[model samples]
Target chain A: MQAKQIDYAKEKRKSTLGWAVAILLACFWLVLTLTPFVFMVLNSFRKQFDMLQQGVFHMPDPWYFNNYVEVVTHGFFGYFFRSVLVVAVSLVLMLIIASFAAYPLARMKFRFCGLIYAGIVAMMSVPMHVTLIPIFKLTTDMGIYDSLKSLVGPYVAFALPMSVFILTAFMKTIPKEIEESAEIDGCGRFRNFFMIILPLSKSGLSTLAIYNGVAMWNEFAFANTFLQTPSHKTLPLALNQFKGEHALDIPIILSVLTLSVLPMIILFVIFQDKLVKGMMAGAVKG
Target chain B: MASKTENKSSLAKVRGKRVAVAATVFLLPTFLLIAVYFIYPVIDTFVISTYKWNGISATRTFIGLQNWVNLVKDKNFWDAFKHNVVIMVFSILLQIPIGMLLATFLDAGGRKFNIFKIIWFLPYLMSSVAIAFLFTYALATNGGIFSSLASLIQGKKVTVDLLGRSPHALFAVIGVMAWQYTPFYMVYFIAGYGNIDTTIYEAAIIDGATRGQYVRQIAIPLLGPIFKTACTMSLIGSLKYFDLIWNLTQGGPVNSTELMATYMYKLSFQQFNMGYGSCVAAGMFILITVIALLFQKAFVVKEDY
Candidate 1:
């Protein structure tokens, strides 16, 4: 009876401490995480002079909504559409291609499979920046310089390694019995993979599709460098131009940053679970 | 694991080959794209690195490894390398361990793990530009919260030029990198920790082993492969870290925080030296690949933990 009483006291103490510490840590994280958004949100309501002259700690005195209106007038919607165009097309192509590529590597017992696998892994390690010049030259040479075609091809190339790696690993987890049975049942190898293996690998494909889609959407470097014209530009590059023109305007800057991240924030808030699960599946590599 | 998964008869195996052929045929689009876009550019990067051309000058002068030879004596190249070494050390020293600790905290959070996990890993999923912008506000020396805290705690006006100094700037950037990525790494380690055998841990406790001993002896040894994978990724990541620093400071204030990748960017885009830029890119590519490959070979447990 004495031992039981002591155990109860200990449990109560643990509970109190856990709640207290967890709340404290969570608060600290929340503040740090929200600082940028807070600053952006606050500045979006301030006038230009009130921003740089006064400290960032200054409250949004006399809150104004003019900057956000200005952003819409500056062609943010076009930028948004172009971003969607790039992300959607690139992802669909990557998925179809990666599915086909993963099949041969995972299922077919081809000669020199080890060599091919290692070669692909090496290709993965080679930085895309190394070929920036050649690619730019080639894109211009092929006369697809500022078009969507230029974006699609290289994006597929760079993202292929990881997608293939994930799909291949996911493929390995699938048991051989189903494939063997399907073949015995007179279904062709192609049909076996398409009907049986493909269904099983939905998690991997979904993971790749979402992550790659988000990345292609957020891409700024290649988009800015390769596609120079305003009409061909994506969202991030468009916002970056806002930065260049309005180097000192805090409200405009804040609005642009918000405009850039708003879509991702919305998607994440909704589909956060699927994203994490997919990330884990792709990253674990175990 | 199945014996019957093997083909029963040679006649049946021939049919499998036909199916395999169809699958391979379907894979042609991907293979052809990879060859043209990926495989070609890399080979071309090497060839271009040996030439002296101003991108669109229409004349490619054969320089024959002059770029590599020049890079050998380049002070900026060495500086970038040194900076990356500092980044790699700081990232491993701070981020990896913090990630491990956070993973433990998240694991021990009981019913709150799901909520805390989402909150923590939120930054990882955000794009580099977004995070970099946020961190710039948070870490900015002037009126930044971090500086404000420093002043409040130390009871004085603390003015740290976080983006303008040498050692301080590098550490500040590294600090942000660590803070931003700890959660991503935390989840991976958490997954690794979940796979640890609870039965062994229980037995260890029953045998009078302390929690420290159990973790050190059992957990670490068991987690060897995952730990190695994490380290390999961080090492490569630190070396190739471009976007975060690029967005925050753009390798500015006299190249104090310049990395190989960022420096390569500067050379190619800002300086317009196609030759020098490719050289740096090639050098970084080789360095990262070699280190990662060597680490994998050294520490990867081929079969199982």
Candidate 2:
């Protein structure tokens, strides 16, 4: 009995040591992760020249707010709103079209169902860079270059493959009897989709929305390529615009970075659980 | 009886036709958009690669395989590709293992560690462009975080030229990429661990296994498929990485930090070398597809566990 007790004590000590190490490493990483953010947030409150005078870690002397005020007044919201508009329109269209495609691919029997589904899924690995030049040409040729409308098509197209993939997988889980009963009541495929299948796929659609919504919001390559006019630019390009204007003013640029990242951080905080769950849904399936 | 059978057959044909029409109507928009944005563009990229016209010009000359030949021999293009490979290797190496460690820590600690999860995930919330700009200032030579810390320790001001140097720039970029993406893999593995049946853990404990032993033996092995998926994602992500690098360095300071995407961007957009840029982009696409396929074929197996 005494020997057994000693073994128990030994095991407890070993685990405590493990826990200590784990906690130390976790704290180290925590510091590393927060340092840059601390730098960004802290320095944003300083005067432009004060950043150079004071240490990076030092607290702001007067806690200036003018940078934010200046940024907001200088069309920051225009970029933010344009981003919101583009992401909203693109996300809705992507979800609807993806669901439409996913429905038949998931539930119906068509001649090219397997082949078409495979084809769409295969496009998941095709990098967006290959299409960059041609899409640029297409945009300019269509006379929609430098406009928000040019972004919509590429956004929806790029998001479709993965959304369709996930939604199809999600729809496959819906019991067939639900759709079969609806069919027996003389409902056609269109009505069945609008009333039955679409309603049941709410969780899936929301997951896709959160997933694709983030991508569309932060999209840079296509936005950088297609939009040249300052007003048409999105949040991703806002930093470059601000940097171009305030070439030497580090605090103003930092404020712009902080402002551009603020909305996402707010959304993340408010919808933390849903957002994590949504991302997990994509990760597991993807 | 024959008349009744014919009537039923005709009705069945009408139903089939209606189903076909519904399918067509449902699938048309997705296919149309994809055709315009994805399929046609890829084909057009290859076709444009054979021409000598700038992206804006109305006139074009068919240069045929000359662009392809130049790309094959181009030192800068190959150097960029090598950089991509380096980043891919390091990303998979650093991000996955570190992320797994963080996830394992959270999993072992359970609900009490939720705060760590939330804090660790904050980096991912910010867009790459924002992070790039943030780090550009954070890692600057003068009045930067590192220099401040160094000055405090060494009793003198010390500047750290991370983004401006040649060899150090790529590694700095890699480190930043890790900082940005590690949280993603952490959450991914947390989900993987969550998917594991609790009964399995109970079973392991009943067999006198320690928590450490159980994780090391069963949990990690069970995560093989998820691990493979994560590596594949990192590989492809590193190969086509553009946004952060573009905003951070623009593949600069003597082209030390160039990747395929950045190189292609410079050529096509900055320099207006449309034909050659098309070739490079096409080359990158082919390389990524082939590498991803080869990775899947090599590592992805039909595992029962």
Candidate 3:
């Protein structure tokens, strides 16, 4: 009976110490994570004089919004729209191609299936940046240089291995009985893939879309290299322009940076679960 | 009967042919894109690296192995590579450990700590370019947070040139990288920890295990494979880090923060030495591929704990 009585006082004491330590660590990391963003937002409202004379910790007297107005008037929306277009087009192309290729490798019996899968997996280890010079030359020779076409082709190509890998892994988990039943209904291979397999793999496709969308949206290296025209430049390149033109104007630069950053943070907030799941799925499956 | 057998066999052959046709039809587009954009570029880069050519001109001068030899002796290349190595080491040291610690706390701390998990993960969601701009301003010596903090601590006006000084510039870059990327591993580890059976933790607790003891003894041992994967991911990511460094420093202060990617860009695009830049690209390819394969062989192959 005495043993059955738990030591509640002792347990409470132990847990209180644990809770204290955990809360302390969590608060420390939270502040560290949010501090820069807070500073950026705060500085975005102040004028150049206030930023220079007062300091980083200064509160804006009038909460000036002119920095954002300047950023918008400087043609930031074009870059934003161009980025959206590139990401959307690249995702559609990547998904269709990757799904088509993935369906056969996952379900069908082919002699070369293993070799093809291995090749795609091995391709992941090859850094695409290593082929920068050649890609630049090749695109120029193809007369697609300094255009969005250059970004689309390579973006879709490099994203294929991972996309195909994830889709194939997801497709493999789908039961074969569903397909066999469809086949027994006089459905051809292509019809069965579109009618049966595609609908069932919504999770995988969405995951790929988000994963590839985020990646393509932030792609700077290829875009920076291929795009030379001012109008053709993406958001990242346009934002980086401020470093040279408005180096001293911290408020304007911060406003531009905030504009580019908010969409991603909002997307992530809306689809946090899907994004996390997609990333984990990619890493684990790979 | 003979006619029936022949028709049956012919039907089987036709089905097999259709399957082949379908596979080819499905794979053709992806393969063509990969060939034109990925495979061809790699081969062309290797071929071009052996010769001397400016990017634009029609004339190409073939000088065998000269670019390769020059790349091996290039001080800037070595400096860039060493910086990559430093970033890699620092990332593995700080990012993984901090991620693991935070994951452990969130897992063990129960639902009350769940909100902090999301808050800490905010950085990982934004683009590296945005993150770079934010930190670049925050760490700016002129009226920046770091300078303000330094002044506050010193009881006088002081400025900390975190990204403008040698050696410190690379460390500052690494710190920003960790600040942005550690949440990735944290989320990753949280998922991994969620996969662990709670009964094991219960068993440990029943055996009178402390929280620290449970993490060290129970958690780490079970999370070995995940840990290895995280290390590989961090290593490979660090090796090719470009976007943040490009916006942050552009390999400034006498090439202190020069990474392989930034250096390669400077050589090819800015300097217009396509051949030498291709050589650097080739070197990067070799290093990335070798390190990845070697790391896999060393750590990932052993599945059994």
Best by TM-score: 2
The digit string of per-residue lDDT tens for model 3 on A160-233 reads 99888989999999999999998999998999999999999999999789878988988888999999988888
Lowest summed lDDT over 10 consecutive residues: which window, candidate 1 chain B? B1-10
Interface RMSD per candidate: 4.8, 4.6, 4.3
lDDT string, candidate 3, B107-219, tens digits: 76555665787788888867888888888888988877889988989999998999989989888888899999899899888877776777777677678876678788998
True contacts kept of each: 0.32, 0.67, 0.58
Tell how far residue A73 is off in model 2, in angstroms.
0.7
CAPRI grade of model 3: medium
lDDT of 2 by residue, A54-158 (tens): 887899998999999999999999999999999999999999999999999898776888999989988888899999999999999999999999999999999
Stretch of 10 with least lDDT, candidate 3 chain B: B1-10
TM-score of only chain B in every candidate structure: 0.87, 0.93, 0.90
Q: Once superposed on the true structure, which residue ranges of model 3 sit more than 4 Å away at CA?
A: A1-13, B1-16, B110-112, B197-214, B300-305
Worst 10 residues of 1 chain A by lDDT: A1-10
DockQ scores of the candidates: 0.36, 0.50, 0.49
Model 1 DockQ class: acceptable
